[model samples]
Target chain A: MKFGFLMREIGQGLSRNVSMIVSIILVTFLSLTFVGTAGLLQAQIGQMKTYWYDKAQVAIYLCTDTSPADACPQGEASSDVKATVEAALKDAALTPFVERYYFEDHQAAYDKFQEQFADNAVAKYVKKEQLNETYWVKVKDPNKSAVIVESFTGVAGVEEVRDQRSYLDQIFSILNAASIAAVGIAAIMLASAVLLISTTIRLSAFSRRREIGIMRLVGASNFYIQLPFILEGVVAATIGSVLASGAVVAIVVFFVQGYLAQRLPLTSFVGVDDALLLMPLIIGSGVVLAAIASGFAIRRYLKI
Target chain B: MISFSNVTKQHKGAPKPALDAVSLEIERGDFVFLVGASGSGKSTLLRLMLREEIASRGDLFVLGQNLVTIPSRKVPALRRKMGVVFQDFRLLPNKTVFQNVAFSLEVIGKSSAYIADAVPEVLRLVGLEEKADRLPNELSGGEQQRVALARAIVNKPDLLLADEPTGNLDPATSAGIVSLLEKINQNGTTIVMATHDVGIVDRLKRRVIELRGGVIVRDDKKSGYETALPITDQVPISSDTEPEQGNEPEQANEPEQGNEPESRISSTDQAEEQE
Candidate 1:
């Protein structure tokens, strides 16, 4: 048969089973919505990981004049000790891992502490004489910061060394778990959608058994008879995916950007622009899901 | 041309065979009528010829294809060489008369140029050129049957197997259908009609094969009416030269006396017997 004839038949078949088509569309839309949501969450989590980890720094505190430990028993680090610590940081062995280092004296630390706690009662206790000088070091790899921290710990005149990634690591563990759960739910819903589509197509075929029989007797090839039904399923699924992507975009814009961006500005969650960036991925996934579901469904039920 | 040797068909779950150890041959260009009461396997015989049902034990050949062993995938190619008509007229309700007729040619991948020319020609042959645009529901019973006939013969199949094509029509309409079938046969398309319409059989005076309980009880080339009795008398007369009423039941029952009817036989029967 001609391609035009096949298309016309597919069009007529879809129109004739309009109610079934609509049902398929609704099922596919809801399923793909979950799938898209899971995808966007994963992307957002990755983005947050990149943003927080890249700027993370290791803070090394130097003993001040009131310190109790022998490392700084004189209650202040001598100029020679400070020079030794700075020279050790700049050694050729550590140069590749260390990006840059900046030193803060007691007066600068006291001012920064007071500025951070300006509204709190702690601001009174954070006096100029009690604050310790510190060195803030940036590293090339946040994941490898433990090695550098261990090297700096217990060094002469070094009171403490801590990487800021521990807090971010906890948050990322939760996000990773949630992403896995979302993917699991999406997979289950996807299977259900495929089964529902296959059943719908089977029912459509059963309803038209007489027509199929006639076509068979008339020497129609197996492909010729099956193409229209398969195309019908695919068309319904494509429409559903498009609807789902639109829903995702709308939800991201109205809820995530407009509401959450204003309400929780500090968390650095998904922005409307980021969601828009996922448009190609969302649409591509939808098409692939629909095509696979429709292809397998036709193969199972419409075999000649 | 068709031939069957010791053909027997036993349907699944049935106690008896549908066709029991029967042998028959139909020559090319001959119009034959298969007549039997319901449950006597007339339809089964027609189906066997069409390869719709395979024989349980036999060698059957239609148009030189060994039907018992032909693969299912090749059935369509074999069916394309023959036309079939059904009692229900099996016309697609949504298709126009023109499309219905054109569908036959479409299956064989005929070019649009050929279809455009061939479809109208076939419709005109069936005298339905004016009703080309109308759907099957818009046509009457007889007209629908004619459309089916147009579809069946459009490809000029080698044989036509019609199973009760006129069973639902009125007597006059039925006669018209029989005449159309005859006209097609005269133009050299072999026809095998399965019907219980005795009036048509007696009136048309064609070769008739009568079946009873899955056996060919009577095969006759010449049968004349015993006008002294009612027209319902069902008897087999083998000789065209013999008078209609003089043959006794005892003589008709003689077994294995194949030499008695040599003079009345045709050259076709002689050739068949030689084979």
Candidate 2:
């Protein structure tokens, strides 16, 4: 209630426990930075998932002369076999799951193979007739590729049904593990921050026990005595929060944007806007936790 | 005003109650002296009056509010109407006299304008106006106790409780502090002072309530310490025999009286020791 007096007391308390306060700030900063990093990593993972899953397709390979004899018992897929596969893709039963499907004949496949191996010597020996034709089917939902795979597998002309998501799944699992590790580290750091903040508050209260005793005798309410100590923790943690937000923003700007985004142009990365969005959450949590820790810690000294 | 009806205070882990079946009434504008030896419950009585400790049995009332069942949240409001001083004169060592006195007002959320005026006025009353900027360590024992006194009364409380406030002062200096208390009491602040100083009690001849072994041995209207001493000269007895058995060791260890010179030297040393 007494703003000036509380401010003066907070200032004095912070100054008296300068070393403790600084450690609280540093710990809060480190912990909240990890929190932001974890959040940003999850966001980036989500972005990449959206980008890759949207482009993911189920490729059904048709039998060719060079295909394994077990898959192509007739030695090669005839025109009628290609026609049957195309009709199955357009069937009314599969319409809901299929977004679109394109036929890549042996000629188109050979052209892509040649371009892919333009610098290799084998590009000249591979003939168009030997390459298997593929039906590239993009599904509405990537996870729904199971329906399309079940439909074409072991079919008369199909050699293999391949979902591109299988490859992307490996990448995502690695990123997910990274995100989880960041969160685990953030959790540990935050716990340390809470303990450190409470210790700092306890030490401050101990050093000012005489003042607190006098205040209690003079009819100062519990809230009146605790506000300054709570504010001391809040102020230090807020500075840490701001610094963490700044670090998160810089990470997005420099590492995500300038480095990762530049080097890995195909994959989407978390941006500055995402980091800015996380600032409030990071700072809010820091302030709330610090206030609670200090508030609870100072209660032992305010028995009267 | 404070009233205790058959009040009993039993502290945890103690062999006997701190106060047993004590009843007394202190009206508004009365300066009452609670004189007792160590562990005789004088401080406990004062503490109960301030609501710092609750009576284990019987009803206790202060300023017309029942202290037994009063909600803890309302305790601060009750305390604001009273001031308390201790034997140690607990002044913040870093603060100057002005700041130390102003601190009481500040704690109760008084405006700076009121504090600026009231602090100097109270310091002037305690004869510390010139030493407003001096730290607690820089001041003498008498001056430090006066600052504590000034801080206690700065809020203009309805009652003042002093628990052995002059215990650490010399005879002459304790006289000065008592006179200051008398001046404050004259201004209509009910004062309840707990003390072991027989010299002050003998000199003042105030309303003395003496306790021995958790029970009142004497209550006199305008009586000196000699009139209150007949119970101690003979074998101490209690309405119940149990407490009398516990009083033997306490009575035997009672500090010898008429040792004002030694006490005066220790008072100065204690003041310096705090620094």
Per lDDT, the best of the predicted structures is 2
> lDDT (0-100) at residue A86 of candidate 2?
87
The residue ranges of model 2 lying beyond 4 angstroms of the native Cα positions read A68-75, A122-125, B231-253, B256-275
Instruction: Pull out the clashing pairs in model 2.
Output: none
Measured against the true structure, the TM-scores of the candidates, in listed sequence, are: 0.74, 0.92
For model 2, what is the error of residue A205's alpha carbon versus the real structure, in angstroms, after optimal superposition?
Answer: 0.3
Q: Indicate the docking level reached by candidate 2.
A: medium
lDDT assessment of candidate 1: 0.76
Cα lDDT tens digits, model 2, B1-275, are 78899999999999889999888999999988987667778888988888889999999999989999898888899999998888889999999999999998899899999999999999999999999999999988989999999999998999999988887777668878988999999999999998766667656778988787778877888876556435544534443434543444334225534345456455445434433
Pairs in clash, predicted candidate 1 = A65-A75
What DockQ does every candidate get? 0.23, 0.71
Per-model TM-score of chain A alone? 0.84, 0.94
lDDT, residue A9, model 1 = 73
Fill in the DockQ of model 1: 0.23
Candidate 1: stretches off by over 4 Å: A59-96, A101-109, A126-135, A149-162, A252-304, B1-32, B35-78, B103-114, B201-275
